[model samples]
Target: MHRRTFLKSSAAGALVMATTSWPLGARTRDRIRVAMIGTGLRGQSQLGPLLSRDDVELVAICDTQQVMLDKTLAIIEKTGRRKPKVYGGNGDVRAWKALLAQKGIDAVFIVTPWEWHASMSIAAMQAGIAVGCEVVAGITLQDHWDVLRAQQRTGTPYMLLENVCYRRDVLAVLQMVRAGLFGELVHMQAGYQHDLRAVKFNSGNPNEPYGSGAEFGDKGFSEAQWRTQHSIDRNGELYPSHGIGPCAMYANIHRGNRFTHINAFASKARGLHEYIVEHPKGGANHPNAGVKFKLGDVVTTTLRCENGETILLQHDTSLPRPYSLGFRVQGTDGLWMDVNKSIHVEGKSPAHKWEQAQKYYDEYDHPLWRNYAAKAAGAGHGGMDWFVIHAFIEALKANTPMPIDIYDAVAWSAITPLSEQSIAEDYKTLAFPDFTEGKWKDRKPIFALDGRY
Candidate 1:
C-alpha cells in the first residue's frame, strides 16, 4: 500500500478503537482541563509547557510527599490561575486514584515513577480520561500489555511522551526514509548514552538531588526513590525508549513489521559506585558510601525484526560519557550517522565519501518541525518537548489520535523488561512479544506522514 494510504488505514484503526468522542469537558471544545498526577520534577517540568498554552488549564496536582505537593501547589498558585484541586499528602499512597476520580479533568500527564506508568495510564483511561505519560519503558513486560489493553478496552487515548521520536533531526531522517532517500531499510543503531554519575550519586543526598530535583526540582527525586534501587537490584537495558523510539519509527515497527527477538549483554558495574567513593556528598558517612551498585555500567542489546531489519540498542547512562543518542540509520542505498552529523547516499554523493547532513536539512526537515520551529524555540531538549506537547494539545483539540499512540508507546517502551530477561540468562536470545498480535502487518501509520496532522 502507498504510504499515505497506510497512514489513513492506521488512523482508521485508532478511530474504531477511540472512545467514540472526547471525554467530558473536552467534548465542548473548551480549554483542556488537565490534571497532573505527580508533582515532582517531571510533573512540574511538563507543567511549564502546558501552562504556557492558552488551550490548556491546570485543574489538579497530586504527589505522595507533602513538601513536593506544596511546592507544586505554590507553582500553580503563583500563576494566579484558578487553584486546581490538590491531592496527596506525606505518605499518601492512594493520592493518585483520588486525582483520577475527579469529575471534570479531560486528560492527565503521568510523570511519576516507572512503576506507576502502566497502572496510572490504565486507570486514567478506565476513568474516561486521556493520558500523556513520561517514559523509560515499563517496570515489567506485562505492564506494557496491560497498558495497551486498557486503551483498547476503554477507547481512551494514551500517548507515550517520547520527545525523541518527534525530534527535529530524527523527523528529517523520517522524511528521507519516506522519500526513498534511504532505500530498503536494513539496520539502525541508537542508545541512551548520557553520563548520569552526578544524578545517580546525588540520589538521597539533601544537597544534591536527582531526577525531578536536580534540574529545577526542589525536592530531589521522588516516587519509589527508585533509580538507585534499580542499580542495586538489577541491570540490563533498564531504560530503552530513548534509543528505540526513533529507531522504531525509521523501521516502521508495529506497522509494517515488529521486533521478533533480542540478544542482550552487560559490562561490569563501576560508574555510580566509583563516583560515590570519589566524591561523597550530604553526610560525611553517607549510606550510599557503602552500597555496591548492581547495575552494569554499560548494556548492549541487539534485536531482529520480522522484516529482516536489525536494531542495536545500548544503555550507558550510568557511566561517564558525552551525551548522544548514538543514532545511525543504514539502508541499501544510503545512511546517516548522528555522532558526526553526516550522511552518505548512493549516486547522490561523491563516490565512497561522506557529506555533511546539514546539506539536506533545508529540503528534508520534517514539515511539523519546520512549521513550529519558531514557536518551539527554547522549549526544551532542542524544542522536541515543545513539538510533542504541541502534538498532544493538537490531538486533544482536533480529537484526532495521538502522534505516539498506545501501540507505538508500548512497543518501544516494552524493550526494557524483555532486555532484562535476555541479560539475566547470560545473554540469551529471547522472542519479543507481538504487542499488536499480528495487526501490525496490515496496519498503517498513526502519526503524521506527509506534513499533515
Candidate 2:
C-alpha cells in the first residue's frame, strides 16, 4: 500500500480507538491532553514542537525542581497555550503521582533520570495514561521486565522516543534496505563516540539550570546530570541507545530477530578520574577527587543476532574523541557508513572505492522524509524529534501501537546493564533476556515505509 493510504487507514484506525472509554488518549474528540515530567534540557527542548501542535494540549508540567516547573509553565503560557498544571517533585517523592492522578492528562512523557523510568512509566500506565519515555528504559534487568509487564497488564501502548531511528539519513538507508539495495544483511557497527568530558565534569554551572547543583539533589548535582554519577558506579556501557537504537531498527530486533548474547570488553576507567585529579575545582583532598571510577572510557560490546548477523557496539563517551555514532550497515551487496555519509554498491561501484552517499540520498530518502523533511516540526536532534513526537501523538490520537513499543524499549535499553554484567565476568558471553519470550518470531514490524507509525 502507498504511504499516504496507510497513514489514512491508520488515522481511521485511530478513530476506532476513540470508542474505548477506559484508555486516556483514546478520547472521542482526538484532542490529547499531555503532561511533561522533568522539564530540564530534554523536556524543555520538546516543548516548542509539542506546543506548536493544535491537537496536543500541555495540561501539566512536573519536575523535582521549582525552577524547571515555573520556567516551563511560563514558556507554555507565552505560547498562548493553557498554563499547564505544575507538579513539583522537590522533596516529596509522590509529587508526580498526584499529578498523574489528576483526571485530565491522557499521556505523560518521562524524560527524567535513568533510575525513575520504570517506576514512573509503570505508575503512569496504571493511572490510565499513555507514555512517551526517553532512552535507556530502566537501570536494571528487573526494571526492564516491570516496564514491559506494566504496559502489558494495563493494555497501554508506549513510544520509546528513539529519535535517531527516524533521522533523515538513517531513514534513507532504511529505505534502501527495504528496496533491496543492500542484499542479505550480514554485519553492522554503531557506537556512542562523543566526548563528554566537560559535560561530566562541569557539574555546577550556575548559569545553566541543567548544570546547576539541583539535578542530582542538593549534593552538588541533580539527577538531571546523573550520567557522571552513573559512571562512578558502573563499569560497562553506561548508555547504549544512541548507537543501539538505530542498529536495532536496521537489524529488525524484537520484530523478527533478537540479540542472543553479548560479550563485552572494557578499557580501564581513566577519563573521569583524570579529569577530577587534574582540575583545581574539586580539591585533590576531596573524596570524589580521590575516588576511582569503575566505568571504562571505552567499552566494546558484540551482539549475536538470532538470524546469524553480528553487531559491533562501542561505548566511548568518556575520553577525548569526536562524536560519531559509527552507524554502518553492511550487506552482501554493499555498505553504508554514517561517519563518512557514504555507501558502496558491491559490483556496481568502482573497484574497492567509497563513493559519495549524497548521490543516492535523493533517490532513496525514506517515504516519511519525502513528506515532512522540508517542513520544520520545531524540534531538536536534527528534526527527528518532531517525527517521533508526531508519531507518538498520532498513535495516541488514533489508538494504534507505537512505532517503538515496550518490547523494543526493553530489548534496546537492557544492553547497558547486560553489558555491565558481561564485563564484570571477564567478558563472558551473557545471554540476553527475552523480554518478548519468543514472540519476536511471529510479530509483524510496526514501523515501515508504509508510514503507519
Candidate 3:
C-alpha cells in the first residue's frame, strides 16, 4: 500500500479505537496506565518483572490463550498489584484497541509475535498511546519504514525495547569509549549464537509445554504457522540487534554515523537439510520446512557504517553451544574486546596489555549505579531491558528526545530485510536507507548519567 493510504487507514483504525471508555482518575496522574498484549513465554518469563514497576500501572492484559492470561493475572493479584482485566479469543487487536481507547491507558506494551509487531504498534500510536515493542521492531522493511512514518504523523513516541544496549558490561564499554579509551572505534564484532534445532525442528516426539501436537504441525499447514514456530531467519540479520546494539554504541551509529551498506551470506545448510531429510520425524519434516530453507549452518552479515566502521554479526540456531555474544570494539586509540578480555593500544602511552585491561574495566557498583541500575537490573538480557523502557518513559514524561528515537529504530531494524536481500543476492552490498536524513550526524551520543566517563 502507498504511505498516504496506509496512514489514512491507520488513522481511521485509531479513530475507531479512541471511542472506547476509559477510567482516568487521580491515580492515573502519577502512574502510566499500561496494557500488555501477548502474555506468553517472553511476556510472563522475562518482561513481567520489568513491566511491573512502580511508575507503571498494569491495567489490562490480552492474550490468545485464556490460561496464560489467567496465570499472569493470578501472579499480579498475588503480588498485591492491581489485577488487570483479561481479554482473549479472536481479534486481540480489537480488545487491545478497546484498552487503548480507554482514557485510563497511557501506553501499550506489544509482546506479540513478529507478525503483529507493526500493526499493534501502529494501532497504539494512532490511538494516541505510546508504544513499547520488542527487538527488531518491525517485521518487514516496509513495516519498519511505515512505523517511522507513523511515529512522525501521529507524534506519539514509539520505542523499540532493545534491552542489550543497557547491559552492565555494555554500559561500561560505552563509558570507556566516551573517555577515548576505545579510541576512534575502528571496527566491531558481535553475535547471538544459540542452538535450538531440536526444539525448533521438533525432534524426538512433540514437546509442547503450553499444549500438545507439534508446534509447526505437518509440512502442508501454512507459511504463517512456520514463521512463528521456526527460527526468525526470514532475513539474514533478522535478529542482528542482539549483537548490533553493543556494536552500534561503540561505532557511534546514532550519534554521529550510521550504517551505509550491508552484505550478508548464509553458510551452506546442506548438512542440516540432509539431516532433516534423513530424519523426517525429527521435527524438520513438518510443512514448515516444505521447501524454503535447504541450507545448513551459519548466516553471517557484515554492516559497513558511514565512517568506514564495520560490524560483523553472525547467528546459527541449528548449532549447539552456550549463548555468547562475541563483542569487541577495535578503536583507533585503544581497543576493548570482551571476547578475550584484552585491550590493544597504538599510542604514546604505557604498553598495557592484560594487566591494564583489568584496570580499564569499571565495576557497576556505585551510588549512581544504585539509582539508575535498580530499575534496570531486573530487565531481561541482563539489565539493558529496563533501561530501554525507563529511558522511553523518561522521554515521554520529561518531553525529552528519545534516547533511541525513530531514526535509531529504523536504522537498527533495517538490518532485517536489508541483510535478507543481500544474502538472497549472493551477499551483494546494499546501500542503507538514510532513516535519519543525516540528522543523527548533528546529535551527540547519549551517555549514562552516572558520571562514569
Candidate 4:
C-alpha cells in the first residue's frame, strides 16, 4: 500500500473509532478495557495472562479466520469470563476497524501478522488507545518512521512486546552487565538461528499435527499461511527483534548509544526449496517445489554503535538446525557465550579458563526473576512471556513509560528493511536512521533496571 493512502485510511479509521472524547494524558481507569486484534497462536498466549488479571477486561477480538476466532472463543469460554464482542468471522479483513470503533477500550493488543502491525498500531494510537504490539514493528523502513510519527503525534502509549528480553539468562546477563562483571562493553553477537521449515510449511488440516505437510498459503496452518510468502518475496534478516532486543538493552541502544550504520551479507537460498521437495506430502512434482524463494538461508549483519560498541546479528531459519539465539556478550574484562553456556572473566576466572554459566546466573540472578519466578512458572517461552505482559500491564496501571518504547521498537525493527537494502546493494554499508531525532543522547535505560514490573 502507498504511504499516503495508508496514513489517510488510518486517520479515517481512528476518527470512526473515537466517538467519545479521551483526554490526551489519561492513564488509569477503573479497569483497563482491552481489545485484541488477530487471535492466532500468539494472541491466545497473551489472552491467557489478560484473562487471569483482575485489572483487565477483554472488551473485543478480531480475526479474519473463523477457525482461529472459534478456537480463541473456546479458550475464553473455558475461563468463564464475560464473552467479548467478536469481529471478522467471515474473512472480513477490516473487522479490526469495527472493533476499534467500539466505545470504552483503553488498550489494544495487536498480535497480528508482521504486515499489519504498523497500520493497526497507527490506527489504535490515533484513536487514543494504548498499543502493545508484537515484534518487528513494521516490514519496511517507511513503516517504522510512520509508526514513530504516529506515536509522537498522538500522546498514546506504544510498547513492543519483545519477550526474549526478559528471558531468565538474558536478565541475569543484564544484571551482570550493570554490575560491571562484563566490564567496558565493547562487542556482542546474537542471532535468530532456528530451523523453521516446519513452521513455514504445514497442512491446512487442523486435525493433523502441525508441520505435517509442505503446503502453505491458503492450504497451510497457522504461520505457514502468510509467513512463507516472505521467503518468496524478500532476501534479508526477516526477523531481527528476537536477537536484537536483549542485545540493544545491554548496549544501551537509544539510551545514550545508538546504531550508527549497518552492513549485511546473505547466503544462497536452498533450505526451503529442499524441505518442500523432500516432504512426504510434497514431491518434486508438487507445484510449490517449482517456487523460487528470495530469502537467503542465512543472513549475517554487522552494526556499529555510536558508543564505540559493535553488534553482530544473524538470521537463519530455513535450514535444519537446533534452536539457539547464538548470543555472545563480550567486553574489555570478560565475555559470555550462550552456545557453550560458558563465561570467562579476566580476574575472577583462572587464566584463560571458561566457567559454567549456571554459577554466574545463580550468583547474579536478576531480582525480577527471583521475585516473580513462582508467578511466571508455566508461562510461554520459559516464563519470559509473562514478564513482557506484566511490564505492559503494570506500566499502563502506573502511568509510566513502557520498558520498550517507540524509539527502541523502530530501531530494532528497522534492521529488517535496512539489511535488505544493504544486501541488495552488494553489502554496502547504510546509515541507520535516527528514529529518536537526536534525543537518544539524553535517553536513559530503564528496562528491568530495578526489577520492578
Question: Per-residue lDDT for 1-453 in model 2, tens only?
Answer: 132343333333333332343354444446889998788767888998798888999888888777667667778778987787788756555577678777878889999887888777876776667889998788988888877876776676677988888888888888888778889889999988887666665545434433222122234434425667787789887778877887888888888999998989999888766666566555466566666678888999999999999999998977777888999899999999988888999887897999889978888877787787665454698898888888898888877677888898998889988999998887999988898998999987668547644
- Cα RMSD of all models vs. native, in order, equals 7.0, 7.2, 5.1, 2.1
- Sorting all predicted structures by TM-score, with the top scorer first, yields 4, 2, 1, 3
- lDDT preference between candidates 1 and 4, better one: 4
* C-alpha TM-score for every candidate: 0.89, 0.90, 0.83, 0.96
lDDT ranking of the models: 4, 2, 1, 3
Taking the tens digit of each residue's C-alpha lDDT, what string does model 3 give over 49-99?
Answer: 545567777888887656567667777777788677777744344565556
In order, candidate lDDTs are 0.77, 0.78, 0.66, 0.89
Q: Tell me how far candidate 4 lies from the true structure as C-alpha RMSD in angstroms.
A: 2.1
Query: Which candidate leads the pack in TM-score?
Result: 4
Q: Which ten residues in a row have the lowest lDDT in candidate 1?
A: 211-220
Candidate 4: tens digits of C-alpha lDDT, residues 84-144:
9999977888888888778888899999889999988988888888899999799989999
